[model samples]
Target chain A: MLAVGLLGLILLSVIALFHSLLASTSKSNDMTVATAMAQQRLNELVTQQPSYRATYGQDFPTDVLGQAVYAHDSQSTSTFYSQARPELLKDDGPAFGRTYYLEVQVFWNTPDANQVAANRHQQGAQSVKAGRVVYVPGS
Target chain B: MKRGFSLLELCVSLGILSFVLLGIFGVFELGQSSFHFASLRQGLQSEARVAFYALGNDLRHSSFVTVTTVPRTVSVILPRQESRGNQTLDRDGLCTAGVENWESPGAIDIHSGFPNFDSFVVYYGTSEPEGRLIRQVVRPALVGPYPNAEFSLVNSMHDNPLANSSRVGVTRTLSKRLLSFRARRDNDSRLVVVLLRLRGMGGAKPGTGARADETFELTLKTYPENTYPRV
Candidate 1:
């Protein structure tokens, strides 16, 4: 009986470790997806700089530029999304030339939310826990 | 004397230990997941700051004169102001009442005044999902006559959405999820404003709840009008 009990405890610990690994893997995947979305958008914004400058003047307005615009061509349709504000902090020191700022944000659902309720009910008295993913451009 | 416990008793104790171990492991995994999430949140804030700074640099140079006048309220330097004294005469032909309207040159009205003068209206063109696009019309004073008239169309920071050929190497935005974009001339003649939001929740249609959902504030300043002596 003692031998059997010890073996069972060992199995439980192994199972717990396996579960933690799986959760981490899932979170990593979600983060990659969000990052890809953000990077692609950032590249597009940079490319459109010249024309956007001509249309909106040298000084672009956040309220006017940050809003969504649905534009289409013969080949396909694309949405031009812009951040409400720039994505970076400015330096107090003066610099030459005009520079345009671009910022991208990526968000994903938390893995914890899906399992929180189940864990909570099963524990009954114990505190339940969970996890999520969010991505920003700079850091 | 006999063995401390029988095999049967030992087995029962082992089963209890296993149950407790499993519970503990579950809790540990939960903590790991939470940490990953926190990393992502911090990343978002950092990216927003980078974008704001890049744009601000350009706005600081919007003025024509490095030190034309002290920075003040918009009203003080308005292109048109009521005359401070008599409207009768001034050394310069400019109206004695106030500064002459820089845009009064009939033929060159659009291009005169400021160098590379462009309208400041914000526009959301049909483009991509979660995208913010703007178009401005600029008039340059250097007129060469005929085909190359002074007036020209330019894109804001983002490229032009409507392009017939890819020759320009302009890529079309894949989404339209722009939020709020506001700008104003700063005391230094630089364009200063903050963008409140951009990008929708996800695969949301334009104007839908997801599409309009943006929660970031990015302030940027660029394009200072140069100060030029009046005629």
Candidate 2:
């Protein structure tokens, strides 16, 4: 009876370890793919050279990155924003703006909210986050 | 201690031992698969970094840049090795290749117009899915006639490649398992966005990701500092 109980305990511990290992591997792989997605977005935006007046408030896809059938335990997607800060700008050209500051943020287990809250007290979190930025002329 | 008489103890012990062995073997299989993926990802990551270094170095110093669609090659016009001291670069971009009548060889070697020939570096792959990336430097022929052939040099290198094959100076292969290399010229940013995908030689093993999805991809936009500085 003692031997049986000890074996059962050991088996449970082993199962728990394997579960954690699988979760960790999935997280690592998701993080890597999310990073690559963020990089692709940044380069595409820079190459497009979006004008501030045109794309200032528009999202690239207007939707979340859809989960594939193979994706399990984690979800992934990315979004981009275009803004112009006079203080950050070397020279703020005009009212319409000649320069744009573009940012792309990738999230695995992405946040639920589409827009970031203005209230500081609001809590929104993501387990995995990666981002890239570039400055381009707003044509 | 019932002298090998109890069958219950023997059966129970054998069952536990079998369970332990099964668990160990399962872990071993999982470990093997994990190790394979980790190594594959690491190898591809390192190769991508090396390719980035080569592309970045050439793009940063480019005097002009050209990209082709079909085979997907990037050709950069780089200024020839500047003449040291009083040495003048001849039509072949070598001080010792042969002196042209226009070059005095020791008179400051300054030209009123742009020099006829500049060093060219072309980055191209062999073919799709299993291509090897190649970078070649070409210095044009001595005493060739186009006085202003900045675009013409690359034109000939692309159109009549056989005729200009002899002009190729050095060729270096970057990667062996390149799946695709794409470059898009962003005229607004004056930067080229380059994308490279590398795959492993063998087929993907039993894994979570499919073989087609196992490729490692890298993308970046780079502008020529020499060509667009303060412009």
Candidate 3:
């Protein structure tokens, strides 16, 4: 009877470890994806500086930054969202020939709270944990 | 006699094990699919970025070539033309499009002394699936005389095609789909604004279908000789 109990415990531990590994990898993938999406939105806005400067008088328009949602989950869409915001501007004070900005502040979401909790519980059965990562664009 | 295990108990245990394995496999497959899509989305996004930058560079340095002062014709000037820029377009050979030269390499001819200038029109319609095709018409500055006869420098992003708009048609295939196209001038009134939109390849929709409408916008800034700061 003791041997059977030991074998059952071992099997449960193996299952828990496997689940932990999968959850951690999924989180890692999500972080990478979110970061890339944020950067792309910022680049598109900044590259069009010349045109915007000519039309809107060199001031970075905050209202122009738009939001997008990405479906990344399975069985249901995993929602990944991002938006662009200006951080700095170098205008000529109305006399310069060109304008530049140190635009920043793009953010995106990771997986959902409930989803992460449930996934963590599944791994915790064998003392495994999910890996969470965050990325700030410049730093 | 030896006792045997009950069929019901055996079946129940087998069913539970199968269920556990199925759940694990299901999650694994889902994770794999998500990863693949994430990579594909990233690739398409990057390609779209490169396309935008390419168009933006050309637009920022756009120069207008003058073909005629009486009936002004303008051509977008490029730093250099590609060798394969020439393209012969024949849709049953009924209609033909070709290049028309300007008065000089970077001259802007005027029509009746007005600001009216010539432009290259690129036509984009549904033809290829999940691919972009562009056709540009190069109109010369003059019609006849020694100054005319289609200038020797045949310019194009693609190769130079037949000059005869009546003979072999002229068409240029762009690197991608032309999304939103627009041009305007700055407060100086001579500086020009050109906005170009290019479609992304390998998108969820490659053609003008339900999901293939992914596009990138590029903006370019330019100035006429009169508006440019003199060196």
- Give the winner by TM-score: 2
Tens-place lDDT per residue, model 2, A24-131, is 544454455445455545544544444433664532323334322122221222332222112133434543343334445555342343443112111233223333
Better of 1 and 2 by lDDT: 2
- Residue B4 lDDT in candidate 3: 85
TM-score of chain A of each: 0.44, 0.54, 0.49
Prediction RMSDs, each to the true structure: 21.4, 12.5, 14.5
Q: Give residue B164's error in model 2 in angstroms.
A: 9.8
DockQ of candidate 3 compared with the true complex: 0.05
Model 3: per-residue Cα lDDT at residue A97: 35
Task: Quantify how close model 3 is to the true structure by its C-alpha RMSD in Å.
Answer: 14.5
> What TM-score quantifies how close candidate 3 is to the native fold?
0.38
Instruction: Residues B8-112, candidate 3: write the lDDT tens digits.
Output: 989987887776666556545544443444454444345434534543343333333321111111232211223435322111100112224445543333433
List the pairs of residues colliding in candidate 2: none
Native contacts recovered by candidate 3, as a share? 0.00
lDDT of 3 by residue, A1-139 (tens): 4754665666566555545554554444344434444444444444344455457653344442323332223123344433334433333343443333334433334343222212244323211111112112220
Worst 10 residues of 3 chain B by lDDT: B89-98
Cα deviation of B16, candidate 1, in Å: 4.8
